[model samples]
Target chain A: MAKRGMLIVLSGPSGVGKGTVRKAIFDQGGNDFQYSISMTTRKPREGEVNGEDYYFVSKEEFEHNIETGQMLEYAKYVDNYYGTPLKYVNETLDRGKDVFLEIEVNGALQVRKRLPEGVFVFLTPPDLMKLKQRIINRGTEDMETINKRMTKAVEEIRMMQDYDFAVVNDKVENAVESIKTIIKSERFRVERVFPEYEEMLGDK
Target chain B: MAKRGMLIVLSGPSGVGKGTVRKAIFDQGGNDFQYSISMTTRKPREGEVNGEDYYFVSKEEFEHNIETGQMLEYAKYVDNYYGTPLKYVNETLDRGKDVFLEIEVNGALQVRKRLPEGVFVFLTPPDLMKLKQRIINRGTEDMETINKRMTKAVEEIRMMQDYDFAVVNDKVENAVESIKTIIKSERFRVERVFPEYEEMLGDK
Candidate 1:
């Protein structure tokens, strides 16, 4: 039988370049793994595909999945629903391909409860001052919104201790290298690699 | 203040090439750390140093250390004594240098209890057949002793699950690379690098 693929939860504070690091890891060749595409009740944005970008569905369909427990975890945001689908994640892992879920701290924690063996990685900035600069450089939010995000960032960074690994995003290449190292090391964990060995020795 | 260094325990069945991989790591210029030299009452062989190799000591001295709680763990083997010194390990760690302790599974477990943060890595041969070949290649034992060592090897391999990481010693270079990856990833643990951030976030 094929070995099971690892489930990885990637979480970080807003504007810490988590998306960029995730892109770099994929760009450096992690195509064997699946990037989980979440489902949402919100309308598809311009150029976004219904099933590829997200499994965009109506409110009724989303509520139905939630009721049937098909959703791994879901949250309502600004009158729209967003969630991870359990079916796709299970299918992807069963196919012997690892799955990456880029999620917020809360969502990652919820997933951790369901998948205890899942690897949770927290991406962090070098320091708080650098984080503030990166957030303002985006120019996507006013000072009030920026302040709120900074507050949330502090809270998220605190939750980093709950993570299995932390990659400091001072440099994108360095952060990607750290993440790659973690993935490789996790693959060598005895519980993940030696179940057959355990059984064979048990019989002896 | 300088950050604290991690304690790393390296354990494997005899002749799994743990020594060779460790030497390669040091030879490849990764010696910013210290290797913990264990103390023993066993007589020094030819060319072995008093302090540099094993801390060759008298039986009384070994027993005295055990009574005084200076040793981390002690074992009586073939009418001789051996144990790890807690002082040297703590001093090396306090100097912000990672320490590698080459030990058996039992000794590794004892150290782990004392240093709960230590990383435990179990190295293994590719298979039992290869392990027997490696032991025979050492040319230090007769057939009877070889069989005895092989039996011990199987028993040691069974305890691999207690390790945090395991590397199959199929090739020297590959095993060294795997160990390097484990060290790099371990250094990125959130608690090790981001304690202040965790405290400031008020989530601790």
Candidate 2:
């Protein structure tokens, strides 16, 4: 059997640009990690391929998956379901392919409870002040909503303690570079190399 | 006080190219880690700077340091004493500067005993068969000595379980790159970044 691969979860508070950094990492085309395709009940947008963009499914299918404990993590938005299929992730890892999941902090926490061995990376803003500035610059939320976001951001950033690594998203390029470093180093970690080395040494 | 820097120890079995990999990493000049200068009683050869090349010392002084428990780890080769200065390493780390140490397998084990927090990296040859070939090609040792060395190499390689990471030294440049990745990702590890992030989050 092939060696199981790492489950890399990139997550942080909202407005920390996790999605932008993840896109940059993929667009750079250096890594071979499989993007964890999310199963969603919402209709795919124009030109969106079913498997590439997401695993398009009916509401009944999504709910059945949830009841069967097949969803690694899921969230509902606008009366639609979005989730990661647990079986697909496990199969990919079993095939020695790393699975990359860019998710919200809450969803990441949920995955962590199920897979503590997974590498949870918390993408952080440079600072709280900077994060607040970014949110304010968006100019989309009302004052009350903005204040609530700021508080939520602080709370989520504090949850960085649960993460295996914390990469400050000061710049998209730098963040992508650091995440690459993490993945490379993780492959060399002792736990991953121990069995391989022992086998090479003729250990049963 | 600055955050204590990581103590990165590069070690492996004899003839595994630990020295070559370490030299490539520093010669590449991308890393800023200060090489932990060895305090030696051996006479400085041509062009060997007192501090840059080594901390040249008399036999009496080296012996005094050994008596005082001031040497981090040392090994006697021929008639010369070579070991890392405990004081310098601690002071540098306290000042937020990393210290890199390239030493023998036994010496690295000693350092691990004293400083369990250090990042011990085992630089492995591709396989034991390849390692045997390297030793045979060297052709310096008699058959009996060569057999002893091969046995010793296997024993030392088993010590990799004490290490934090095991990098395969298939190519010098690749090993150097992997070490660089390890250093970079280590700084982002939760144990190292927890304090920094907590302070950023207003922890006292």
Candidate 3:
């Protein structure tokens, strides 16, 4: 029997470069997993391909899929529905291919509740001071908005306690390498690989 | 306060090449952990440096250490005492240095009882058939001894349930790399790293 692939979830607070690190993972190649192409009712932006960026569908189709439980998880933003398709993810994992999901923290929270076995990684900045500095450097915002954003960032970071691993994004390269190490070592976890070895024991 | 270093314990069924894989890890360098130097009452063989090979000690001294709870775990083998000194391990970890222990499964079982936080890694042969073949290739062992050894090997493998990771020694290089990945990834485990990140949260 083929081994079920792991669900790799990458998420963190805003401005922590989760997207950049996720992009770097795929761009560097040698990855054995498939990127999640979310299904969305939102129309494609300039240069965005339908199947590449998302499985663009009409709102009616999206709502029908959600009704039928075809959507793994979904959310509506600006009157547009966006979600991961349950069928694609299940088929890929059933076929022994991993699926990678790089989503916002709120999306990850929903997925976390739904999938108990996911490898949820929380990417963090070196320290809160750096994050505060980054927020302040975006000088276009007024002081009130800046304070609000900092408060929100702190709240998001507190969510790291829910994760299985916390990786500091001190350097993109270092964070990427640490993530790769996590993926590689996770395969050797005894619970994950014990069945194969047990088979070899042969009636013992 | 310094972060406490992890204790990495590597063990496996006989002939699974635990020692070879461990040597490959340390020999390749870039390792931040100290190799376990067991204190033993056995006389050193040729070319064996006292402290480098084993911390050669008198039987009285070894017994006294054990009686005082200085020994993490100990076992008697052929009229000699072999055990890990708990004081050295604690001091090194207090200084934030990791320690690697390569031992037989019985020794691993003892350490597992003494140190719950240690990373217990079980090295496995690719399969039992390969192990039987190697046993047969030895030719000097009688059929009865061969069967007994196989049964013992099976018994040892059952202890893998106590381990956190199981690395297949399919190839020395691959096993070495996997061990390195395990070591690297362990550093990011939330429970090990959460305290520092929590401190950064301050009054939150």
Candidate that would win on TM-score: 3
* Cα error, candidate 3, residue B193 (Å): 1.7
Sorted on TM-score, best first, the list reads 3, 2, 1
* Tens-digit lDDT track of model 2 for B1-204: 467888999999878898789888888896778898888999999999999879999999999999999999999989999999999999988998999999988799899999888888999876653654556476765777666756765676678788989888888989998998899898898788766545544531
Report the first chain's TM-score for all candidates.
0.81, 0.85, 0.84
Best by DockQ: 3
Across A115-142, the per-residue lDDT of candidate 3 in tens digits comes to: 8788889997766545545554767668
lDDT of 3 by residue, B164-194 (tens): 9998888999999898899999998888887
- In CAPRI terms, model 1 is classed as acceptable
Per-residue lDDT of model 1, residues A88-131, tens digit only: 99888887789988876677878988998998899876766355
Residue B135 in model 2: lDDT: 60
Q: Where's the lowest-lDDT run of ten residues in candidate 1 chain A?
A: A195-204
- Alpha carbon deviation, residue A4, candidate 1 (Å): 2.5
Order of quality (DockQ)? 3, 2, 1
lDDT per residue for candidate 2 within A81-136, as digits (tens), equals: 98899999999989989999998777898999998888889887776545545564
